[model samples]
Target: MITNDAMTVQDQRTSKIILAIAAITILLATFAGKMPSGMIGALGIMVITGFILNYIGDRTPIINQFFGGGAIVVIFGSAYLFHSSIFPASAEQNVTTFMKSGGFLAFYVASLVTGSIFGMDTQTLKKAALKYIPVILGSAFFACLFTGLVGMLVSKSFYDSVMLIALPIMGGGMGAGAVPLVEIMSGKTGMNAETLMSQMVPALAIGNAIAIVMAGLLNKLGQVAPNLTGNGQLIRGQKAIEEEDQSTAPLNVTTLGVGALLAVTMYFVGTLLSSVIDMHTYALMILSIALIKVSGIMPTALEQAAHSWYKFVVGNLTPALLVGIGVAYTDLNQILAALSPMYFLLVLITVLGAVFGAGLIGWMMGFYPIEAAITGGLCMANMGGTGDVAVLAASKRMELMPFAQISSRIGGAFMLILATMVVQAIA
Candidate 1:
């Protein structure tokens, strides 16, 4: 009982206990047809549970890590298991009903507004924007161009399939951009939008699982790869960046609040403009950024809001989206069974291509290995949406979380514009 391994044993026991509690609670809720708000309650529980576990873990490192990982596995694994059992009755109907419920629209609007308001700077923020605006704009432009070209070559039908694949990637990875793309393709091509979306819901869930595994593997690879480079020269730039970051002032609450407000304002403004101008969402995003910058409001507010918004989107909204998907899981075997091979192939190609390309480009740009990997994820998410990017972004330990946020927003805006233009051209 007093052995050195006692702690390990206790940790395992604690993890199992938490997992069991979660599994049972989820099962009861799901089976009783009482799963609250289309898995919204479930997602909230997961987050709250995760936070509790994390807090407990902080006190006991071994237990913390064990339960942290175990809790997630249990929650998701159990949800999937429970969902599968009850899926036969009305998967199609359930998913369609949820989609039409407009949960996603609300989530998107909230995220956009919150992100815009929180993304802005409060103090001397405008100056920061002037400094970083070019870099952000340039990145967005290229990312859009790249995503558009690739999305076009892949075929409209393929785009539809990729959208499906992108969803799970987003759900698990926090990639939101994929959903809109899927919707756009469905609307433009007269495809079976609901059926396609239903097929994607499961794919996204699977993608989320895969993204977790991939993130771990990539993180390991990043750690080991740097060792191969000559001693000293390998991480000079990275070290320099880190040192530079350390010297900068830390973000404060008022600044953060102001940023959130600005991001929120921008979201509504952008939405309004989109409805009136009939332009692509990405175009609207870029226009919003431009207006915010030129309005003498200081780009920093947007930047800060963007940062806060990213956290909120990833931590809160993203999980809610997943729950939405879970609620939509009614069991549509017949529809999924009818999916063409081309559709599957297109999805696989687009995801792999985007991931690989983003990584390569990030690496070429001299970004840290983790940053590069995130960039790859962002590329996929941006091309697809937030769900995919969040998955990729989550894979790495970032030195600066804000960079990932800005990169995602900028990249997504660019991709949206590019995708829309491509669709328009083909039409």
Candidate 2:
């Protein structure tokens, strides 16, 4: 029999080879013209291939981490290089446009509706409603106020770029709710939704990357931002743990039925509410689903359903939208030319402003220091998107890792709404 050590070595080598193949395939697919019907197919294959490789690496912990991180770095880096060279002008626009179109809409709606149907209960719903109301409303007020101040200080183009930055940050931070708000303003104002979305996606992607980087930096800085005690820890800490436990629980028919019922109800409610609110129906659907899960009316099966649904929506459905955005890239050079010196300044200001302000607020409120860093990083990510936040978070490490992920997501969502309102006021 093959020695265990030898077998393990072989597995590692195999895993690496597989991942490398996937990486090369993704690169070729991204740049080469003959692979698929359109950009959507190309992106779909790339994302799917990446995820699949990650999934296969799951059994081997070290290999998983190494390959997963490596894949992300390679793919994202190549994408950036590709964007800069081939699609520079319209890269950003392509992302924004994909985000604004029905593709994103479908992705968000599906995720929210399915998530609500199976994931939430009335009690959880009520809590989320209560929690988010103050947070979102406060964020909206502050966002609008800030936008006004910025408007007074900046040019129209500057304001436009700021809004662009805010879109992905909001989406990543707040979830799908922010997308509608971004889409609405883009559509009404004729902001070249496609172009804006394209730009926003890469920006967000870059921002997420930045957020990840910042996590490492914050740990090194040892700024001692804040630390939540038992209560806060209990509230936030239970999430991942609870989710893990939930995953192990068995699925039952009754629970599944109830979850389905609730999901269906929320979908309709979201649709109905969207007509009146001028917000994304997906947002309302998510809200509705949260209510169902929190209420505790459903069986435990609903939890599983919700998880599956979220995976479907976020993982499967959203990628298509991403691809659509990719296809929208017709004039990358124009986008680059549009980037004036002031734009860079604005980017800096926005990044620092959100990071310091939000980080300080989170720290003072007894959040973890890492969470505080994430809060800061989120200001950049939500406006930019996941890529930026990832960059920011990855730059840091240790305690900051959780914070970057959690706080940015929390803040990004809130800010998306706020940013949308800001654009509306300006219009």
Q: Can you give the lDDT of residue 228 in candidate 1?
A: 25
* Candidate 2 structure lDDT: 0.44
C-alpha local distance difference test of each model:
0.44, 0.44
Per-residue CA lDDT of candidate 2, range 1-427, in tens? 8999999999999999997787677556545643444345435453554354334433445432322232234334334534566533333344445455424434444444465335422332343334333332333333333533564477645455556654444454323533555576676687776776565554443444344334444543443333332211212333454445446544455544554455556667878998998655545565555555556665665566654554444444433332332333222343345355554444334444445555444444433334443434443344323332233323322112222233334444555556656667877
Candidate 2: where is the Cα deviation over 4 Å?
Answer: 3-32, 38-40, 43-45, 48-81, 84-128, 136-277, 308-343, 356-427
Q: TM-scores for all candidates?
A: 0.50, 0.54
lDDT by residue (tens digit), candidate 1, 252-371: 676556655655565567678879886544446545665554475654434554555455555544433433333442223433553565544444443454445545544454444344
Query: lDDT (0-100) at residue 413 of candidate 2?
Result: 54
Worst 10 residues of 2 by lDDT: 396-405
